[model samples]
Target: MRIEIPAKKRLVHETRVPIRWGDMDAYRHVNNTIYFRFMEQARIEWISLLQQSTHTEDAGMLMVNGFCNFYQQLSYPGELIVKTYVGAIGRTSMDVYNAMFLTSAPEVKVAEGGATMVWVDLITDVATPWPEAILAGLR
Candidate 1:
């Protein structure tokens, strides 16, 4: 049987994360919630790259929405290759997609997820337009 995995677009960033024992559940598999943490780790790295390139001190993005779908069970004593991609860009928001695959078999995806991030003004707590540098970087 063949499984239809979701197709991803251009890659924005990728990171490797080792599974910790505490990340597992009673079932001896990685907890579902930990998938989000992996995505967050990749997202932070992407943001850090952007910040370094733009040298901007402005407030970072706010995650307005997020989701994850599990395709296969992941166990500890392994590492994951988490990849992030740019999906869609709006005036003040952009969609970020993520996929997690076992390092042993990079072609086989274990989980997929995404999040909608909104640019916000840290001081006013209001949505704001994406900075030129940020938009360029995301493109």
Candidate 2:
């Protein structure tokens, strides 16, 4: 199925995560690496919620690839709200999109990103088709 990445109307889930001291960079702002962490948190939350609703586990979803675009800077002692959603559900993988905005400056979008995760067998570490439960939950 073709899914248009929503321009504004839909945000699958929003999560608030605190900026920790460990996240501070040499410039004294939340490190660039930390932004990826925030994205991961958002993605996991989405996956976990979907799993809970479907009575399944997230171990089946593996992070095969991901990326981020930093448009603005965020400093310490701030809260980040991460918005996430399923961008597409393919035969063996799914794309999860995300956007991060500083709660302190709700008007500013700090970053936008997405990732490709493949359904896999943890033991075998091989790609597999999207599980029926996950596909159903996406709908």
Candidate 3:
């Protein structure tokens, strides 16, 4: 099946991660909790890249909400291509989406997930509006 990201979302980042043997559960498949970590790694990597380009100090993002859905089982010793997408840029928050596919089977998504990310002033610990550079980095 052809999976389409919503029109409102923009593909911002992509990375690949290897599935480690320790990531598996007793069922010999990837544990459900590890999927969240996989997504987190991709998101943090993307955010760090964005921060470098934007050069925003004491400014970052927080995952206010997050969720995931598993489509197919994932096993060990495989690389997964994780794609990150952004949607609905609000004043201080936006939606982030992630999709993971095994490198050996790029067309099939093993899992998908998302989080509502809020821009924040780390020093003040308060939500803040998206700066131009952050917006530029995403768009």
Candidate 4:
């Protein structure tokens, strides 16, 4: 049986990442753990963009959960285009979705994943409300 996941409604950010030799496993394909790294890069880029545009202070976010589903194997000596999308938003947390595609074959999805990030106070390490400017930018 197959399950159909709904398409992302909007893409908030995207960035290109080159695959390094160290990213591969003994099987010569990108290690599954590396896919999470790709997602993290995209998420950081998204936050950086927001920070630049809004000029907001670094009130940080923490990832509470993450998941990835691999559809195809990625080899070294290539680059990937990582795309990020925002999903549900709450008082202090939000869902982020990511999709990775080979730069050479944009239409082919190599892997996809998501993470839940909660707004937090950097010093206190406690949950905090999302700033107005950042929230506006996210929407």
lDDT of 1 by residue, 13-83 (tens): 99999999999999999999999999999988988887643224666578988888889998889999999
Cα lDDT tens digits for candidate 4, 1-139: 2223347447889899999999999999999999999999998888888864412366667898888989999999999999999888899998888989999999999888888888887777788898787788886
Number of the top candidate by lDDT?
Answer: 3
Which run of 10 residues does model 4 get worst, by summed lDDT? 1-10
lDDT of 3 by residue, 71-104 (tens): 9999898999999988888999998889999999
Lowest-lDDT window of 10 residues in candidate 3?
1-10
Give the clash total for candidate 3.
0
Candidate 3: global Cα-lDDT? 0.86
Better of 2 and 4 by lDDT: 4
Residue 80's lDDT in candidate 2: 86
Clash number for every model? 0, 0, 0, 0
| Inter-residue clash pairs, candidate 4 | none
TM-score of 4: 0.85
lDDT (C-alpha) at residue 13 in model 4 = 92
